[model samples]
Target: MMELDPAATFRQEAADLLDSLETVLLDLGQTPADRDLIDAAFRALHTIKGSGAMFGFDRVAAFTHDFETAFDLIRKGKIDANHDIVTVSLSARDYIRALIEAPDATDPIIGEAIVEELQRLIGRGDAKGAAGAAAPPAAAAGASLASGQGGWRITLAFEEQILRNGANPLALLDDLRELGPCTVLPDLARLPALADLDPESCLIGWTVTLAADCPREAIEDVFMFVRDEMRLAIAPLAEGVPDVRPGFTLDMAEAAAEPAAPRPEALSAETASHPLPGKAAPAPAGAELNRRAEDKGSTVRVQAERLDELMDRVGELVIAQARLSQLAHSGTDLAIKAIAEEIERLASGLRDSTMGVRMVPMGSLFGRFRRLVHDLSRDLGKPVDFVTVGEDTEMDKTMIERLADPLVHLIRNAIDHGIESREARASTSKSATGRIELSARYVGAQVLVTVQDDGAGLDTARIRAKAEEQGLVQPGATLSEQEIHQFLFHPGFSTARTISALSGRGVGMDVVKRTIEAMRGAIDLTTIPGHGSSVTLRLPLTLAIIDGLLIRVGEGRYIIPLSAVEECIELTAADEARSRGRSFLSVRGELVPFLRLRELFDAQGAADPHQKVIVTAIGGTRIGLVVDQIIGSHQTVIKSLSKLHADVTMFSGATILGDGTAALILDVAQLVSLGQGRADDRTPEAA
Candidate 1:
């Protein structure tokens, strides 16, 4: 087992926390008065600060101290979570992230500037009597506590894993001291032996008698971060109770030594059956430790490299299993074939399990873009309401990551070019606030992610003029709307009269196309002149493995993605002869274009008398691939082609056949495009 790096672990945790913090901050902007949002933001900051300090991110912890305080004030109603506050808080959150991600290059003054701005906004709120002078939570709790005894007795029985969760007991004690006078008695009864102790574990509990005139709620707030993992009990001190600090009487000592009362929530079975000696039963709150244990056991953070390595091993196993099955089937031994079949079943299951492990929900990618949209709306002065659908759609992790940049380009284009300005939209009788919807859903075996905008769509006339100016097409060449839209993706092709930071260099969409295509995906563009435009990306669910239909064109075997295959039909000699040099075939009265693989690959042998045409759908276009033979379905482990073969766009990748021979995986999208182009170039009579 590899030893985990504490610093790296902290960084990962911090990154996740930062993401959540950003989301909460964004939500708070819309619901400024939401108490729950305020508390959530505070807790996130507090956790980051504590964890950062513990993991040696001193600068991060230092910066977050003030940030956390801002939210704490909001939580206490001492400040309203208004737009200005949320804005500055977002900036502060970014600076904190920078501090964690790249501390060496980050300047302290930038952080100080953000904090200064935050203080100014907070000062302005203070000028308004802090939201109508509502009493803070601590003060209100104190007022209620003042009605009883002046001091309180508190018991804290922290779970063993509290330290791992980033809670510092000494810090909690110091916070209690800040409230007022306090006396803390350490409970060392549960301390483990030095030889058996885990440094990361927190075994010591605490008993405290506070003479502070602070409220019980204030004391409870001190333990807020670890409250869910610790047992806490608070009660007013009886009059004339001795200060057990100096001389503890029998009763006083006994009371101080007693375990905290069990909370009301039910405990887990394991915890109930094996209660710790002399320790309070962990009710629902204490059960958090058990739950954390179970959760830790259930999910682990494996490195991406490790997962890739595992997938490679699984791929090799699949190939080996295929070879075994091939050997077994070629023989006459029933037992050997049975064993081979069982192994094949196991390998198939393993491949599925491995692929499932690599699948992640699209929401992770979508969540990051929310902040992008928010920032862009502010910068571009376009009040856009960003919406998302089918966030739960899952795709390969590698595909999801690569899709990010492409989606960014698409979204930017939609906002910068497709969306109209407030005034422009008003003149068009459209809503002042434009809408951009980013959605993902499963379409058969592929995932379709669309970035759409309700604004002035593509200017076909302008695009045509640009295309003609660039000599991308003949000056008077006729083109469909889609053909014109395709020009938008050409390198250095832009209709914008002038260049700007966001676009007009004609760079983004081309990059989007290249990236998507590199991931074995295709892009589709549709637009209505004045209504809107939607760009949908069709991508495979996984790049690692797939179900493929293996076929033969002459001597070469090619794999067609099973997901893309609609149906396969025989291509008779009569049908081939009647084509009259045109590649179109009438399928159910539809003129479906077909590509002869033998012609494309320049096969040496004569065409088979019984040829097969595999009809496939790619990006809403159907095309047929004629082959000499059909080799049936296969569990294809995708192995990428070498750079030497990179320019060979006819095949996406390659896979190993059951007989230990390499077969190229046909690029369905490219084949479909080729077929469509072939059909488009034909004479009208041929069409």
Candidate 2:
């Protein structure tokens, strides 16, 4: 039996309630007139207040009561669900959470200020609204009577294994008494003789009659802890049955007048027709209906760490399956081959299902930007309309989580620095309301997320001047547009003359670049003189595993993500000799920069006479890698390098092959940039 901590359970429930409240509040902002949203928000608050008080969070309960009252009014249409009211309630929600978590940390002045704001939004006129007020005695009496007038009959029978779940039926009965008055009768019919009794098993059931004016939900909540393991039946007492309180009361009429001989079958029929006094009704047709209904609506909320753990298990399974397939291929037995094929199919399906579990829609990441744009527009006095497309596009959950901060920096930069003032925009004959478009889509096997702003594009001339001033470029250097624009990502390089909170400190873009690169992704920028700038981030679908094209550079093996591979070609002696110092190969008259992985990685073995070139593309630039042998495709589980090798920029990460050899995963973007530089350096025009 596992003992349960009621306090911990209360805390978890409170946090979930708070999150539900926030989500509903956000939804209400979008649809202010939605009754369902208002009801949901109210229910979340009500549950939090009731549960908080039950769990000894009196201060939280008290603070939340006022907010609940406000929403109750809104729910009943006594007051409109206005923006001011919603905002005030949202602030109060945070304060309530604080009260629950750190009751003593409350500040009187801040509390008074919030109360005043709440009153003003409530339209209660003045500070008098903050003071406690008493209702008339008659009204109070009526409310009390309305609250505790009805008596309920509840029968609770738990499974024999209920004790194994650490539940005490007597404790639940005691909690029910707190509502008003309850009489409990323990049934011993199911209890075994003392000689044969099992101490660990629950041998007792209970019948309880509770007198309370509270809703049925309150009584149900008492047993919520053991609801899954217990069977509960609740029914309201017949009208005006005050004497029918929960104690053991044998009916006097039946005891005094019924000594008649009973026919066994007739007696059984009569007993079935009318249940024993104080006993619960039989399980109705709809008794288990709500449980099944709830099952349809229920979803398990798992922590992200659990998903990561499951993914690691799946990766190990994939590796094992690879080993099994390797062995099966060497055997001549038909049955072994058949079983191996089946295992391979099952493993593949399991891998896909696990990956699907890790995929999350990008909408949650996009939602935060709405608030960002709203605040930034007001702060800068700029009219900006943030638009998003392809929000339904899904990416690996881990990837999306890591992407939020970098995306925020990009959006802030666009609003603070990229977009010009209204007057400046007018002079340029552009619309007064600037637009920023955030879009995401799947490109091949990669997820491409792009942020574009219809604002003043990057000034290449100013960038070039700043680069020279910062000594990032040589004096009188004739740099291309791409070279000039790339300076924006250099550490501590900013064209802004003044700094602000949002941006212009030049500390963010460099971090964004580094973060994207660390994710084994690439970032690219494009802009027009008068049009806007677009930054695209291309990342692999998953970080844990990838389909890799394994090839050998001399004696060393390297992996190129098959997602990025375009094609492979044989580079003969005639072609290799012709392309000497220059790395460009004429493939059907198209120039593609070629990189010798052997020389790049400094492999010990000599290059083969018959070499292969694997051409790959990043954005629009195509580059080729020259390797000795193509080792076919592999399911590579990526393992990051130790901090000691973190400074190596060429190899993004490493993967272990089925045969226990290590292969480096190529950073295609970095390799392409290096290859293009080497090609340009060898050109006669550059010389």
Candidate 3:
């Protein structure tokens, strides 16, 4: 078993806190007067600071001290949320990440500069108050937190797993201190003997006494995250009693679930921790520890390399299982065939379990973009309302990470070029604010992500003129709007006259195209003049294995992603004669375009008396792929092609068959996009 690293745990917890901090900060910009959002931001900072100090992130802890104070002031109604506060706070959020990642390399001056700006913003608020001016809008509207308590008190007993949730109890305790003069007594009555103790659990609870100068909400905010997990009660302190002290013992079973990062609702909706199965009840002080101990096994952090290694092993097992299946079918041994079937079932279950482990929600990628949009709107002076849909869609972890840079480029392009200026939009009777939407959804075996904008659409005339000037098109070229837009993906192709911070060096779209293609994905462009434009990307759900429909084209065998296959039908001699002049298939009253793989690949061979067509759906269009034979279904383990075959758009990747022969996997999206309905059989289409 690998040893648990406390430092690594601290870093991961700190990262989660930072993500939560960012979410709250961005939310404050939209609803600046939201005191709950403000306090939420403060709590995130306090937790990061406390955890940092405990885990030896001194720079992070020290920097967060002043940062927490700024938010604390907002919570206390001492300051109001304004553009300057939110902007500087966002910058501080990024800086805190830098401090966490590389403290030694990060310039301390940046942090000092941000803190100075924050101070100036706070000072200006103080200035108005000193002049006896009217309170800020929020405070005037009574949106700010109450200043004085109504003799209220709170008793909080957090679940034992609070520490696991990446929340530092000490941080909450420290925040309570900020409320007013308060005394905290730690309760260790529920603490088991040291031998049976879990360091990650919050074994000790706390009782507190405080002056009635602070509101009850302020105290409750301290235990907000663990509120559902633990017991919390409040009441007014007795008139004669200086403080309320209640002694309570926690039920061991009640706090069974650890308060890990999942309860925060931020941190990419971090998963919750469930008690490990088969865990023996609390052992006495002297009992021997279990060597197979697994703590709160609902979630475990394993290195990416380890997962990759495990996947490689699974792939080999699948191949071996395939060989067994092939042998079982060839031989006439019922018992051997049954064994192979059982092995197949076990292998399939293991594959699914392994894949699920690597699946993460698309929300993790979408959450980081909110800050990007916020910052871009401010910088570009473009009042764009950014929205996201289908954020909960699950995707492979590897694909999710690689998707970030390309998506950033597309989203930036949408704002910088696809969307019009506020004035431009207003002139066209459009709303002052343009809308940029990012969405993702599962389409068959692939995920479709779209970045769309409601602004001035692509200027095809302008694109054509630029293409002509650059000698990319002939002088009298009559290219379609899409053909003109394709020029945008050419290297160094930009129409902007000035280069700004966000874009306009003509170097982004080409990179976006190449990056998406490298992942065996395809991108689409659609636009309507004076209306809007959208870019849709189609990507495979996983890179490892998939169920494929295997077919033979001449002497070559190819696999099609089974998710896209609707059905297989015979291509009779009469249908072939009819399609000889036109590659069209009549499927359930729909005229679908068809492609003959044998002819398309120039595979020299005699025509088979019998041919089959695999009806596949891409996007919403049905396309037929004619093959010589249907080889049934296959457990395809995808293997990426070499650089030599990378430019070939017809095939996404290749895989090893049961007979140890290589079979290429067809690129269904690309084929469908390139297939033109009512077009000539030999004339290939381009997208």
Candidate 4:
């Protein structure tokens, strides 16, 4: 029942189609003989051109026609999918996007340049020559016949209140004609005599036969504007059916004169099963066939926001069930307990289903990087091969969408700065073509995504010198190589001797860090001077709900994401008494620093006789958090805190308990860094 803006829908679909086309083209640039990729790219362009024309984007449709023709040649093996051809087509794809977004822009010169480039790539000297040479007379003649394939036969009847919608049925009929070839037959049976006719009321209806190869989707798209106030039946016509004739008659009285016999196909399944094979089975009944056809024809293409909304509702149901289970557990009745158990099971299953809806393969995110690497290599004049692994791993769609920009920035940096030149690589006994591997894997409850390059790695000495010169670190400070590498994320920090358009200005890595942190994720860097460098990003699988280990800090209850908690140990009186101050804990012969939540939060209550230590790890560092009581695990629905407390680094966000009490969600990375003395030494007021 919800209405969507037709223009906005067209734009969204256009962007997706362009993205897919770009990806396939980039792949073909590397593997020119790939027929599947060639066909896929062509299909995407063909669909975009067709849909653009259907939606009144004539300029875009016209511009894309040439590129589509070139790809068509590639599809038919007339011309190979060479790198030069792919590059030119990729540029054309961007031009098509520009045309779709702004057809009226004053940029004739830009269009001319793109067309010239396309002509060169296709081995034609000019657009006129290419158009004349490629255009076939036979194909021109087949156009109208191809467009006249059977499509929707719409029978529309409107009520008297149709005028209230400020719509004219005749205008609606005119609009349908623009979609394809249409023959409209007016139903004069509903029209009144001239003396009795009300000029304002819509008494006449129409039955139209449209011939279009466009799917039922485009047919329904035509009626989107007047769907509510009209009675409409859209059925596919038989092959080669002629246009509807004018002045068609409906003889209702003659049909009422004779008793109709039941169709043999209408017999029950039990009766049909006993039919003799030699007699031939009766044709399917019309009503039964219609039902089956409708079942096959109906489909839905939902926008992602709708799925997110549904997931949120499912999350709410989960929390409500949690509350019910708590109340039922406190009651004495067995019936209440049984019902609560059933509710818990059902809610859990529903949660999984909702999460599944949000799950999308990493391939969708990985596909775009091929194009990124291609463009960056071209810009930098470097030869690089971008390899991806674990693209089949699935993650939340929201996470994947947000990951794109950051990933692009990282890939650009890798191609421009991380990889060495072909001469430099050959001198170092490395391959002429540099390699960058983008891989992902599931670690515990988080997704570990890594971008690695086989080139000259980070220069620790240069980085340290840069850090000191920029006043990012204390003068004469003794820091590890890893600490020096972290300086790459500082704002306006770049070690490049020469600035280039692709990178060098050093504005992107900082943004990547901020974006990842905002998602409650962390980014880490690992490098070997001549081997290569790898940047790994660890992120939670979902943002909405999480498994949390609840604990009490002073009078406030906080949750530590269960994914980060390795194990909990009870600190005995002897161990607690022996260890004091900023450091303590010797677990499995490894010294781990411990922080007491009571002391950290300035609690007034005395420490419990028995304290619990929750061991947690971030990256490679392990630390322990001393808490009063381990309140066990919970399914937490994350609710962000207000702007007033947004700067609080200790708490990532907050959530509401079933009892209407608030519990802060602990930031494990911040806590681990604090316990390891990695938090900023300067006070907030000082900064």
The CA lDDT at 152 in model 3 is 39
- Please give the lDDT score at residue 227 for candidate 3: 48
**Winner on TM-score (3 vs 4):** 3
Model 2, 1-687: lDDT tens per residue? 875466666676677567657768866876889998987787677667656766677777767767876776675445677766776776777787777677798765665677678767777523333332344576676554333346776766666665554455665676688767878877676667899999987767677777775656566656554554554556566432221111222233322222222233443454456453422222211122223457567545577899999998988888778777787888898898888889889989999998998999888788767767766886898988888898899988989988998898889888887888999999999999999999999988889999999888888888898889989988887777887888888999999888777767787899888888777788889997778899999888888889999898777788998877899999987776667667778888787889888888888866787889999987667899998999899998888888999778888889877666688898887888898788767762221
Candidate 1's TM-score reads 0.87
TM-score of model number 4:
0.73
lDDT by candidate, in order shown:
0.80, 0.74, 0.75, 0.74
In angstroms, give how far residue 355 of model 1 lies from its true place: 1.7
Better of 3 and 4 by lDDT: 3
After superposing all C-alphas onto the true structure, candidate 2 shows an RMSD in angstroms of 8.4
* Model 1 lDDT per residue over 138-227, tens place: 776655544236777776666676666556788888767766678888877766788998888777767777886554556665665455
Off by over 4 Å in 3: 127-302, 563-626, 642-651, 668-687
Task: List candidate 4 stretches off by more than 4 Å.
Answer: 3-6, 33-39, 72-81, 104-106, 123-299, 678-687
TM-scores for all candidates? 0.87, 0.73, 0.75, 0.73
lDDT of 3 by residue, 344-426 (tens): 99999999999998898999999989988888888888988889999999988889998999899988988888778878888
Per-residue lDDT over 195-268 for candidate 4, one digit per residue giving the tens place of the 0 to 100 score: 99887777676778887654453455444434434545555565322222111122334212212211223322
* Local error of candidate 2 at residue 441 (angstroms): 2.2
